[model samples]
Target: MVDQRLPLASVSDFATWEPVLRLMLTDGTHRSAGRSARVAGRVSRYGWSLGHQGSLSSTRIAVEDIQRSLARGGVQEVAFSAEIQPDGRTTLGLVWPSPVVEPAVGYPDLGVLVLAEGSLPEPWLRRPDPVPGAMPAPSADLELLERTLRERLPDAIGATEEEISAAEARLGVPLSDELKVLYRVTRVGRGDDFEAADRAGEAVGCELFGLEHLSAVDAAQRHPGWKLGAKRAVRTGPGAAVQGLAGSPGWTCFGSNGGDEFAVDLTPGPAGHVGQIILVDHEQSLGAELVADSLTDFVLGRLREDGGDRRGDQLPAEARVGTGHLETIQAAAHPALEVLSVGPGDGTPYSLAPVAGLPRLRTLTASPGTLADALEVAGLPGLEFLELGAREWRVLLDAGAVPRTLKAAAITVRDERHLPVVPLANEILTLWNRPRIVQTLLYGDLGPGV
Candidate 1:
C-alpha cells in the first residue's frame, strides 16, 4: 500500500493544504507545469515550507511535474509515498492507482519527484523502467488492410509501431492482429466521408476513432459514477439477467456510423465467438449482434456493398428547401417525415420559425442559424434526437426550448475559436441540469483543441 500522507508537513500545514493539494493533483484542466507551480505556490503560502521564500525553485519544479502528471486528463487517481531525508530534502514516489492516460515512456507505475532544501537539486522526472511488457508482432492481414484503405483514401496513413504500443499500454489490453494492422495504416480522427451500407441496407458511415478518442473513452469509462446512457438490453437465456453494454468491456470499437458501431470482441460471451466482428447498435432492440466472423470479412463486405440511400436524402422535395427559406419548413406539412437537416442555401445565416408541419419527425439536424427557428416552430411530437452547432446550443439554452421528447443530442463545434467565451465550469453545469437528455456529445475542434 502507498502512503498517501505528505511528508515533512506540520499538522497545521496538513490540515490546511492537503485537500488543496489533492484537488490540484486530480483536477484534469491543469495540463502545464506553470499551472502546477501556481498551485504549489498557493500551498507554500498556507504555512508549508515548500522551500526558502526567495529560493523555492527546486520545490516548485518537483511539485509542478507531480501536479502535471496527476492533472493529465485521462488519469483517474494518483497515489504518492514520500520519504523525508535527514537533510530536510524529500523524495516523493508516485503511482497512478488506475491510469487512463498512458504513462510517460520509461515509467510504468513509479515516478520520482525530488525536492531539496533551500534551492533545487535534480529536476522532477519519472524513474526508468518500473514495469515492462512484451510487444506483439504485426499480422499480414492488418498490413493488407492498411494497403487497401490507403488505396481508397489517398491521405490515409497507418500509426507507427510505437504509437500502437503506447495505445495498448494506455488501454491495458492487447490489440488483435487485425486492429494492429488497421491502426498502422489509417489513424482516422474525423471521418465524415467514409460511408458504407450494412447488411440491413442502412446507410452506415465509418469514423474509426483514433488513439485520442480511445484514451478519452477509456477515461470516461473509468470515471466514478459513469453509466452507459440509453443502452439497449440483451438477454442470453430465459432466466438470465439482461445484459447491456453501455460499451462492452472486451469490445474495442473500430468504426461507427451515427447510430451503430463495428467492434471487435476480445472476450466472447456464451453465444458470441471470440475475435468475431459485431455490430453494436443503439437503435436496435437487441443492442449488439454478430456481424461477421472476422475483421477481414467485415472490411471486405462493407467495401463490396453499394452505399445505401441515406434517410436524409429521402425527404420530400418540398421539405428539402434551400437554406434561405425558414418559411418553407412551416409551410411544408409533411406529417410522416422522420429526419430533417437544414443548412444555409447561401453563406449567410438562415433563420427558421417553429415548424409545426413535421409532427412525426424523429431526428432533426440543423445549423446554428436555423436551430432557433426549428425549435420555435417544430411541434416535434415524436422527436428522439437532435444535432446542432455550439452556437445553437446557446440559443436553445437562452430560449429554454429543448423538447422533452429528445433522447439524445449532438452539439458540434466547427472550430475551437467558435467555443463560447463562458467558463468550462458553467458550460458543464448547464449541460448537467438537462437530465431529460440521456446522452450528449460535443465534437469537432478543427485540430486546434483536444
Candidate 2:
C-alpha cells in the first residue's frame, strides 16, 4: 500500500504517479535517490499497453518510447473516461469524460506508484513489434457471465423476459459471447459501483477504464502497470465485507453502451446486522455463480424458527427458499427474511402469490399473479409503489382490471407485446367523462403536474 502518511513533494507530486514509484525501485538507503530516473523507468515499463487491443502499434516499444519522451519533460495532460448507468434510465453511462495522466502510476495493493517528469505517456502510441505471439488470453463468455452475476445478485440483477427481448431487438446484432458475459457480470446482482484500473486491479477510484485501455492490457500480458483501485463494497452481514478484485477483468462492449447493477454479499460486518451490501462489479464474471450459490445456501437460515421476519436472528445459516417454502411462509407470523438480492437461484423463475391476512404490512412491491390476483391488492389501501414489470403488467392488462386504490405505478413494457390493452387515449377520454376526475395522464404525458 502506498504510504498514506508520507508527505508528497508538490501538488504535482500526487499527479505524476510515474515519479512517485522511484522511492521503492531499489532496496538500498539511497534507493529513493534517482526519483526522476525511476519515474522514466516505470513509464517505459508501463506505458506500452495503454490503448485498445488492435489499435496500438508496439506494446513494448511504446512503453519504452513514452518513458523516454517523459524524461525530456515536455508532456502535458492526460484524459480518462468511464461508464455509468443513469438513474431511472435503463441505459448504462460514463461519468468522467477524461482524466489527466502523469509519469508515476500508483499500484496501491502491490505498494508502488510510478512517477515521471514531463509529457504524459501513451501506451498505444508506438512502432510495431517484430516478434510473433501465441493464442489470446482466456475471456469468459457473456451469457454465462450474466447468469453467474445473477446468481450472486438476485434482486439487483433484474431482467424480465420482456426486457431481455428488447435488448436483443435494440442491438441490431447478437451480443458477442464476451460482451454478454461482461454485461451480466456488471449488472447481475446488487446496486453497487466498481473501480476501473489499468491491468492490475489497482486504481484511484471506480473510474471505469476505456475499452481501448482494457484491450491493450489483454493483448500484452506485460506492460506499464496501472492499478485498478478497490471496490467500495458495503458490509454484507453486520459489518463490511469489502472484497478487492484480482485484476482488471475483461470488459467487451460495442458502440455507445452503458448500464448498471448492484453487488451483494451475505457476510457479517462489524454491526450485528447483515446490512445491505452494495458494489458495482463492472468486470462481472460468468464464473461468479458458484460463489453466489454457495453464499445463498450459507446465509439462508434453517427452517422452523419463531416466525416474525426472523432475519434479525438469521446468523450464518444456509437455506434454499423454494416455491414450497412460500406456503410455509404464509403460516408464519411474518418470518424475518433476507432474500439474496441477485439473480434467480436454482434455475427457477420466482412466482409467488402473496397470502392475505397480514395486516401489519406497510408496503408490497412485487409482480404478483394474474390481473384477478393483483385486483385483490385493491384491498391494500396503503400500497405505496406498485412495480408492474413487463410480465405482470401483461397479466393485469389481460385480466381487464384497473386497480382502484393504486397510488403510483412503474410499468415495464417490451416493444413486441406492448400494444395497449385499452387505448391510452380512450382511457383518458373515459376518465374525462367522470365528474370527479380532476386529473389525468394520457400517453404518459401528464394533463398537469400536481
Candidate 3:
C-alpha cells in the first residue's frame, strides 16, 4: 500500500531522468566525467541540489520535473544517484521515503530516524521535572499589570470569566495570577491582519494570541529528528532561570514573534519565578530563553533579558568530539552524558574507551574513519540511536557487534555514491524486523556527450 502512494509516473522510466542526465553531462567535463560520470543529489518539497550538473538555467526544468514528481508521490525527501559508464550506459537510482524515514516538515533535523515509526527521541518524551525552588518573581504584580493594561488600552475589550476557564481546561494547567490578570484586561479579538498586528505590537512586544489560540507548549508540539535529538541532551545549568527542556506542558503559549513563542513558565528554572515568561525560538530544538522575569516586567517596559549560555559548551548532557567543540573523547566523557557525537578530524581515529559504560549515554554519531575501533561501540549498553559510516556499520554487522539496544540507526554517506547507504540502512533495519528502504533503479544510455 505504501508503494501505491509513490509517483504514479514510472520512477523506473529512463525518460524521466534523461533530461537531467543530458544537462549534467553538459557541465564541460564530458571528456572526463560525463564519459563515465557519476552524479547524485537530494531532492524534496524543500528544494533540490545537484552537483556536477549544468548551469541552473539549463537544469531548472529538469529539476522542477523531479520535484513535481516527488510532490505527486507525496515524498518529503528523496535522494537520487546516476552512474554513467564509459560505454554511455547509465544507471539511475531513486531512493524513496518510507514510514521510518521521518516526515519532518517544519521540525529540526536533530538526527536521522532509525527506529520504528512511532518511536520518538528521548527529549521528545521528557517532561518538566518538579522545580521546588521556583517561586513568583519579585516583579510579579497582578494588580499593576492589569491596571497598566487597562490604562494603556481603555477601549480594548476583555475576556469573560468563562473564556479564561475554557483556556485553563484546554491547556490542563491553571494560569498564573499574572497571566490571568493580563488576559482579563484584553482577550485580543482578531481585528483584520494589519489591525491585529498593530494591536498585538502595542499591547505586547509580539503578536498576542487570543484565549482560543492559547495552547500548551509540550513535547508533542515539536518533532525533532534523530540526528540532533539523539546527539544532544536537554540540561539546565546550576543557576539557570529557565529549565532546559524540549517543551513543557506548563509552558502556556500566549503570543508569537514570527518563529518564536512567548509563554508563561509554570515550571521555572532554579533561579526563576513560577510565573515568569520565556521565549521558545523555532530555530532551536531545546530550551527556552529568559525574556522577562515576570509578566509584569514584560508589560511595564521593565523586561529583563539574558542569553541561555549557562548550559556550557552546548549542554553537559551532549558532547561533540573532533568537530572542534571538544578535542578528545576523554574530554567529552561525563557520567551525565547522553549524546556523544564524533565528527571528522585531521588526526587519527580516537579510542572509545573514555566513554565506555557511560551510564546515561544513549545516542552516538561517529563520522567515517573517526573511531580507532568500531567494535568498541558494543561497550555502550544504553545506546538507543546510532549513526556511523558504511564501512564502520559493516564491521559491526559482520562481527555481530551491533548494539542490540539501538532503537534506530543510520549509515552516514561518506561521498556521492549513495548506492551503498540505503542497502546498509536496510541491513540494520532488518535486525529489528523493521521495513527496509525501498529502492528503484533504471538503466539507459544518454549517448556520448555533445
- lDDT value for candidate 1? 0.41
Candidate 2 residue-wise lDDT, 173-263, digit = tens: 3433333343343332222344212211111112332222222112123223222111011112322222222111221222111342222
Expressed as tens digits, the lDDT of each residue in 59-172 for candidate 3 is 677767777776777767666777787777887777777776753333212125466667767888888888776789888887888888877777677778998998899888
Clashes in predicted model 3: 9
lDDT string, candidate 1, 1-450, tens digits:
223453322311323223333343344342343221112211211122221233355445434443443344333333232322223232233333321112112211111111111111111111111112222212225556556655665655557889888888877777778777666656555343444213111211355667545531121232111011111112233221112233445567767766667677665444334555666665533334666655655665633122221123233422444454444555544654545567665654444444454555655667656543544524566655555666665566666666655544444323311112122213423443521111111111111111
Candidate 3 TM-score to native: 0.85
The most accurate candidate by TM-score is 3
Better of 2 and 3 by lDDT: 3
CA lDDT, candidate 3, residue 329: 91
What is the Cα-based lDDT of residue 311 in candidate 1?
23
What is residue 282's positional error in candidate 1, in angstroms? 2.7
Off by over 4 Å in 3: 1-10, 22-37, 52-54, 71-77, 103-113, 155-157, 160-162, 190-201, 307-311, 323-327, 447-450
RMSD of 1: 22.1
